[model samples]
Target: MKKSTLALISLLIVLCLLFVWAQNKILNYRTWFRVEEKILMISDRPEITKIAAMGFDGLVADLLWIRGIQYFGGNFSTLDKPEKRSGMMNLLRNLVGLDPHFLAAYQFGGFIINESIKDHEQAIDFLLDGADNNPLTEYPSAWRLPFDAGFIAFYQLKDHDVAKELFLQSIYGKKFAAVSVENAEGVKDDDSPEWLIDGDPFSSTRFDTSDGVFSLNLHDERQVGRVTVQQDSKRPKSYQLSYAADASMAAWQTLESVTNPGFYFHDFEPALKAHAFRFDQFKIQAEEDEEFSIAEVKIFGPRNPATPSYVERMAYEMDRAAGRFKAALDQYMRYYDEAVKKGDQVSADLSLQKLFDIYTNKCIEILQETAELYLQEKGSLPTAQMFELIQEGYLSRIIQQKITEEPGFVEDVAPVLMPTGNVWEILTTWDQKDPHLLITYTNDLGEEDWYITSRTRLIAEQKGVAEKLQQFVNKYKEEKGTLPENLSDLLNEPWFGATRIYEDPMGGEFFINRETGQVEARNPKY
Candidate 1:
């Protein structure tokens, strides 16, 4: 060969070597990614906190940030400089996203991280992305996102409408996704005894993974794109078609010819709900794409249930509005309950949860009656007392009606201290004539409202604030050998710099009496 031809051949050889080296590096990086995941799992295995902490490093820090964002917006302020802004969220998201099986990334990164930091918008976005990206058993986690979101928004943000809507979406999504609607072991949805998923379409109670046999769930009426199949080697690749019925999940069924590789859905079906399908199994032969690698097949199909039904839509709306309200009630109720119990004297009917229901029920009654009331009178246009009186009225009705409808509904319910399991049983309210109590919250206008509010609002508002306050109370006792005489005295201490105010949701104020170290609500009903 000529000199020119020799040099050209050498150059080709060099290029081929470079390509091989680059490919190996990419493969090795993927292997490390898997290794890092294992490290993370070991780090977080609850039983190994101390051990995990020992091995924890920057990789663990990154994992925590990802987890933290879904936890409480990751409290990046606690993470130091650059890690705070590194789009760690997106990086964390990608890590959890592509795997789809890493449920923790979705729950911890998507929900816990977001909820912890109160990053509502991002939380929703991450969840939605997870919903679309998650394959196979995504429904449970996906449904939880909306359900949990609704709960958080309703309970924490005091936004009931959004909460209501999110719950509805969760319900509908579960149905369309073909998820089972059976009560998840210990879930307590107020309306679940009434709410249910509709649709079914399979007759064979028993099925097998035989190659010629195909199974499909036509839960939705959407065009299919591809499937990721997990198979038993003995059976090998099989071409199959599937469809859903009534937008229910338990209704997956097989339809047509089986194809190799991922499916490319043809003859699009656009009826109702989203569709999920796949081949029977994946075999080693299929992995090599010899005949066609197919393992744990999940075919991408058409979107089903394109629009929310009127009733479903209504439920969603209710959840949205109630979510924030419920969330606030939940947070405050816990804190306040702790404070009440600290004295070893319990507050009756004072749980934040009960207060929320009581207050909302009262609001409903007021709206129905078309009446306006005031702060000092028996009833007010919108005061804590007015809400309580109305709530009491509703309670009486609920009790009386239950006697007529389901007389035994409240029979098994026992009077418990605080944090009762059933929402209805959570609180045992103060007697109507009981003294008012102090509670506080940051109001809509961003001002702290503190007052001697009704037992209902007071109980709910104090739920979370007590933890921060308890530390102060404990410190005062530790330093002075007794409790602080006043809020001002606590403020003079080093740790009490910024927390001068203790406000409840309706804005009740806590006062410390000067004469005794004993801390009593200058008012007691809270």
Candidate 2:
């Protein structure tokens, strides 16, 4: 081989080595910059940052976000630090400003702002801004931004009115649809009767005077069974029920006569075969008032497919009451899935509440029962093994089994914000006195997650303690033939085998008000 060719090959090897060394030096320099303990101070002006990014604004914002997460994760500093939290918030705000369509950024950032920073106000602001800017075209039909805003309002701020309004807007968006009325434009004021289709029995529309006409238009004709009238206060002296084919004709067919008022069920003879009906004219003859108020007017036929079968709901309640937690949960799950599949948000919400009640209320009863049995048999407070046994065999089993089932179980467990129309106005009132329901929504790569609220867990523990205390009171009354003045009396009784009342699992003191027979927890942090 020629010496010149050998030298050329050696020179090629040298060039390759030089390239490798240069690449390693560049990587080492970048790593040094990445690890340096530099203070992170975010720009307050998002607009300025956007302008500086030029055409690659979104890409720049995303790169910054990745860097922020890495930095936040690397630093083991306390999240409670004001500066750290402020810097993170500022970073998130800028990222959102650059690309409002970045959903994951909003979700994760809101969670951190609320949980780590504990700045619920700023978190809510972030959610509202995202909701206003990113339309439904970019997200799910049930946009989560408003839903998150509602969560902050109710869970953190305890402002139900604001939460309710936010929830309604999230569900219905801008346009509202009528639930009962088919074509509202066709109905002329007082001339047309208010149609009450298949809805809640308790819901009703007022009928002005006893001597007034109420027209009815059935969606389909069927074998008529009975029409029930629910009055507001006073029952009319006498009322007549009639049916007609159309509004143009005057001759009405009498269904039945209701002499006494209150909830009058008028049954039709031979089952009238007509599509339209009317109150035809009636009188109250009340002493003081000239007009009578009717809460609801329900028209029941042979079989109305719209009406929910109470048999299933009642069966669930019965099974739950009988300590059949697994069966009851299964029943509730069935109804919940059915309602959600049909897009009946009202029924879905109702079934979801029932499921919650069983979990937080009925399940606690079983826990208390287990505790009572352990005390009776072992003559002491329950051990950790006993508690674990109850939890595994009962509580966890029921929930885990359902969660492991079909694909849509997770979504069904998490109630989506859907339009409820008239039901919204009726059910949206703030019931501050009742125990609040908290729902947390999260998505990881399109997989939804639902969890039992912390408040529910706390309430369940309290209810367990309260129920056991009630049993003690009842036993005292049985032995002494009278209610005790205080819980100390039960503890003092020797024959009662009274040990000590169980301490609240969620750090708090339970007290019974002797005057009211009411048990409540004091300083309940949960």
Q: Which stretches of candidate 2 lie over 4 Å from their true place?
A: 1-42, 75-77, 159-169, 174-526
Best by lDDT: 2
Tens-digit lDDT string for candidate 2 (1-99): 999999999999999999999999998766444433223444678888788778788787788679667856754344446646656767787888888
lDDT of 1 by residue, 473-520 (tens): 878889889776666677677778875566533334566555644333
Clashes of each: 119, 3
* TM-score, candidate number 1: 0.29
Query: Can you give the TM-score per candidate against the true fold?
Result: 0.29, 0.34
